[model samples]
Target chain A: MPDHPFLLEAKGLSRHFGNNIAVNDVSFSIKQGEVLGFLGPNGAGKSTTMKMLSGNLAPDKGQILINGIDLLDKPAEAKACIGYLPETPPLYKEQTVSEFLRFCAKLNNIPKKQRITAVDNAIERCGLSDVSQRLIGHLSKGFQQRVGIAQAIIHEPAVVILDEPTSGLDPIQIREIRQLIREIANQHSVILSTHILPEVDMLCDRVQIISEGQLLFIDTIETLHEYMQSSALLLRFDTEISVQQLNAIDHILQSERLADNTYRVTFAPQHDPTQAILSKSLVEQWQLTMLMPEKHSMEDVFMKILREER
Target chain B: MLTISQNELQRLFLSPLAWIILALSQLLLAYLFLTHMDYFNALQGKMSAIPGAPGVTELIAMPLLSNTGMICLLITPLLTMRTIAEERRNENLPLLISAPISIYKIVIGKFIGTLSFFLCLIVMTLLMVMSITLGSSLDWLQVLSGTLGLVLLVASFSVIGIYLSSLFKQPTVAAISSFALLFLLWIIDWASTNAAEFTLLSWLSLLRHFQPMVQGQMNSQDVAYFLIIIFAFLLLTIRRLDRERLD
Candidate 1:
């Protein structure tokens, strides 16, 4: 947490549909100017949590405080501080871009004299000036997604919530949207929920991963990066080698034969095993071909957590 | 609420569906009005010979305004079908409910937006009959009362349309259901013949209350009845949307 007071604080939020639990005891707080990425697989309570925070769905078991105001107790006053975009952008195809965005701004309670300026600011920020007069239905998918983002930030709400903002965009569009999210995160606390792991890695400052309606982890991206720096090295050789023989090399912790001529060499974190392995390979004339540390992607981290929980 | 209504009304005007319904209803009502005039012209001598004869007010504007009411009953579903149902079908109602605006504002805004379009339709039909004043003596009180009765009657009808639109996600289903419901309310009086049934069915029938007002009788009870129905349906729509937002 920073010195700035939290802009959004949700405590013990849970929602149930009939007998099924959709979100279970999720508590998280977002500070000003922080981009909190909500990571989850399908049906992992990401959307449920987002809905609760956005004041669209009331939580069954908990309270949400927006900018020090209780959301349930004072919804109208509190909700004025939020801008939300659902998984599907809510758009009226009959109206053009300017008309729809102006409606959104009005819905958010923008004042009369300031509405034009607010709408224009949003249009410029979302790169929609060219298509501002075009019907949203006629725009490409990328532009539709931009319209969704533009509406979310149109009123310049203090907290912005977006669910799967880039679920179905091309690579360039995804990058552009990521850049837009970064730009919005400068002044607003954004809670972005998406299943795409790279989206979190690219744009999020803090990450909260949920699985089976339960939050499994919440940590900084730097901390997540630390988990990716594995000490195990992947080695390939021209000749086959026994696990015990590979382990006998100095500074080696363990050895496993991965393929016909490849071995996974694990060394202690502080050990410089590459030099020792190379010298030993030359002495023993074991043709050492490739030597590199194993890189751990987010997929590996996600799979490891799921496996651990199971 | 004003913002939502403006946007909703703008969209309503942009689409040709409401325009088509308005045009068709106006043509049919104008035809009905002209035929009523022809019948009154043919019976002018007999009506003049009778004591306290039926003038153009009783002969033309009454029937024209009543016919306008029937037109409204027949076409209100088409007018209000897309109010909220289209938003749901397009998966955009979430945007509406999620806005800082309350469910009551959204429901009321939709009701007023759709009603304004239909109100314009009603006014245009009334304007067509205003030409009657150019050639003959007309009872202005009866005309005013009839117009008031039709406005209240169709406003109630729009309440039902908006409520049914909120209930279903498909606009066609909403339209059909609204017509079915309004038609049932229209003919509920026929479901009974006994005094006990008649007393209750007459009160429940949507058109029963409008006939008295259109006859130039400004009964407070009838006015209260229409107002109460409007309030009930408006409350029902607000509650339905409240529950839907949580779902």
Candidate 2:
């Protein structure tokens, strides 16, 4: 939906640990310069999929294409174009932040002459300049997460895949990390997997919901809401009305009393509940103050999808 | 590959465990040298009381090289306990595996870094050899040959430590396993004396192989034996790292 070329594509990607299928025929595409939010509950194969894309784990079946390059066929070239941060931050506690970043820069194959500048840029971008010399073991959880991000982006790859980047951060730290993700999205496409619903609403341009190792749905935020259509009208009445009188209307599919005077009415999708209620109110000489269709929240949709799968 | 080696070297020196190992090893070598010197003096006094006493200090004191070899065997496991084990314990193996570098390079870089630390310890113990030269008719050629033998011996044991470190993910387990393995090898050598004619265990004794070098006899077989062990273990270490990455 966003105006960008597709930077990553997974076609029938799957992973099996012995007889257990961790990821089952999952497929999705992420576009360049777009933040695609990956939402799934625990044990939903989010980490497994990310590992396959990053070349850390070979997929049992299917293909992964990075910038139209087949990952399995040309793993080195495909890996060179992407960066990944695992769910757990893989850091050596004995090493300082600067030392760890330097290792990461070299591991990513950054040129020897440019390693220092690249590491410095990552430290500045991740807001880790103050604690760059501090041992990673001594830093707080939030700063450790920042160091993890610094390692992931030190080589300046085209796509950055982060698994639960804000899993253990405080509210303020979460906000700061969210801002950092947004800043990084300007330079590279991001695939952020998180269980937090509001994070998706705040930062993601498009979302894909996966459950039970299967992709349930993929759409823009506006389109996802449209998928969860509601046929109920919420009405606030100035005059008090009995439940029996509201239910007596012939065209009413279902009616429920909200309070002393308000009522909620559900009609078929083709039926206009507001117009029907307005006509009924005029015939009954009753005043209607508010009439609006009930809209579903993203949280509601996310929960519904999860619950339905279970 | 160079970057990985540099980082491993930095970590090896920065750890407090390295300093503790160095201090303990130096203390042990000093104590062993003092005790050996006392025994040598007593033997010399006995030999002087005889009518025709050949200068046998060289032969009697040759065991010091074996003592040095034993010391190397005892300390190598501690030096290499953290090579691959610590990385796995801390879940940092993925950091190296996900890098663009090959697994062979990672293992080789770590092996060289660990060997460098062991080489430093060998240099420190050269002070003991210096003490042996004072007020005694010590054969300089024999001393030099023994020192070379000790270097090869330590290198061989360190390679075994690296291989065992890769086999286990816990540093304590790796260290204990290496100790048990080396102790068994020593016991086998001691137990095979009576049946030396048919005992294959005598051939496996690392100390037995180093004896010729300490006596100023540079046997090509001993040199080849040490080289073969080092090569075999290093190859195994490289394979272990590769298996971990694949898994």
Candidate 3:
């Protein structure tokens, strides 16, 4: 973890509805000005966790600290620093976009003199100025989602928690919203929950994967990639080389032919297969063009972690 | 609280449901008044033949108040059915729940908005009272008392409707349940033969207490009964909203 102060901390948080546990003993922390991607499949307790953090659903088992304040013990103080947008945008259909934001500002206790300016700032930030006067029911899904973000940030809280912020948007809208999230993250710590793997890879600095109410991993995306690294070497040769000749190298555990004259070889991590191949090539008077190590993608790491947990 | 009230009032007026209710109630009230005028004219012609007959004006006001009270019972469910039920149905309750405003303020704000519309309907019916005064020696005091009683009775029914609205998640279910509950209360009073032993039911019956007021007698006990019913149901609504949010 960086030296930055932690903005959010959860310890042994759990929620049970009757006999079934919705979120079981999940714990993680996010730091100041950090973007933490909360990754989980459907019904995997992502929304339940977000709800608890936002004060919408109280936890049945442990403690959540927002800016070092316990949420359960001092709910208003804790919530004063957090903003939340649930999976479904809770909007009054009859209310115009501007009207809704104004009400949210009042609900958030924005000072009377600053309420209009704050609402205007949010409208511009969320790109909702065009449809500000339109009734929420008349707007499309994308515009409605923008309105949701507008309400969440109208209060200018310290942390913004969004559950599936880009769930239903098209590619263009997704990109726009991602940019908006990035911009918002500049000023507030964002806890974004999403099922899209690529979104986490593209936007979040760190990710927490939760499955069946259990937190499987919490690490930076870079470390997660390193954790999934495979012990393989990719080689490209200008001249043709027989598979049998490449197999002659002692460190070559397995070899697969690629296009033209290239080959990929898998070996043990400490083996340094490139030196072995180069020495064999020098001995055989054959040319070796390129030799490089292969790195794993986040998708590979995610699948590997999930598979291991299962 | 003021913002919540203004927002609620704006939403209440913007919907077609509110207008549909007001227009239908006004039409019903006009029909009842025209019918009452005709009946009173016929009764006045026969007043000399009947021994110690009450004046047509006095006879007309009681049924008019009863009819108007019954009409309010029908109209209130329509007014309040969507107040809380539609919010939950559309998943919009969180907007109010997460706000700093208390549940009581939200419920009361909505109640006041609906009551204002109901008051407009009462004002429209005052035209009928004006017509009665132009043709006959009608007691203006009786008219004021009757209108006051009708307003209180309508306000009480609106409270019950709002309370029931908060209990159900679907607008249709809320509307149907409120109508059924109010209809049952109306029938219980209609079927009871003894008014003394059923005094509790009489007090509960909005029509029962409204009768003396429509006849120009302002009974403090009756006024207190209506106020109690209003307070009871509004409190129940607040509690219901709180319980839902907690769960």
| Among all candidates shown, the one with the greatest DockQ | 1
Candidate 2 Cα misplacement greater than 4 A, ranges: A1-6, A67-76, A233-238, A243-253, A267-299, A306-310, B44-65, B131-144, B194-199, B245-247
What is candidate 3's lDDT per residue for B4-88, written digit by digit as tens? 6667777877888777877887788778777877877777777878887876457676567678788878877877887888878
The segments of candidate 1 whose C-alpha lies over 4 angstroms from its true place after superposition are A1-4, A236-246, A256-262, A270-272, A278-289, B192-198
Evaluated at residue A188, the lDDT of candidate 1 is 87
Candidate 3's C-alpha runs over 4 A off are A1-6, A67-78, A236-238, A247-253, A258-262, A267-297, B45-65, B127-140, B245-247
Q: Give lDDT: candidate 2, residue B3.
A: 74
Residue B208, candidate 3: alpha-carbon lDDT? 75
The residue-by-residue lDDT of candidate 1 on A147-239, one tens digit each, is 999998988888999999998899999889889888988878899999988889998999998997898889999987876778899999998
Give one digit per residue, the lDDT tens place, for model 1 in B161-210.
99899899899999999999999999888767763554878898878889
Model 3 lDDT tens row, A1-310: 2243678999999988777788999989988888999998898999989988877777878899888888777766777778888888999888899988998998777999999999999999999989999999999888899899989888888789999999988998899889999999998899999999889887888999998889998989887766767898888887788888788788888888987878989987777777778887888777778888887766777788999888
For model 2 chain A, the run of ten residues with the poorest summed lDDT: A1-10
Q: Please, what are the lDDT tens digits per residue for candidate 2 over residues B61-138? A: 456667767877888788778888877787777677666667678787877887778777877776666665576666
True contacts kept of each: 0.75, 0.46, 0.36
Docking model 2 quality class: medium
Candidate 2 local lDDT, residue B18 = 79
What TM-scores do the predictions have? 0.94, 0.86, 0.88
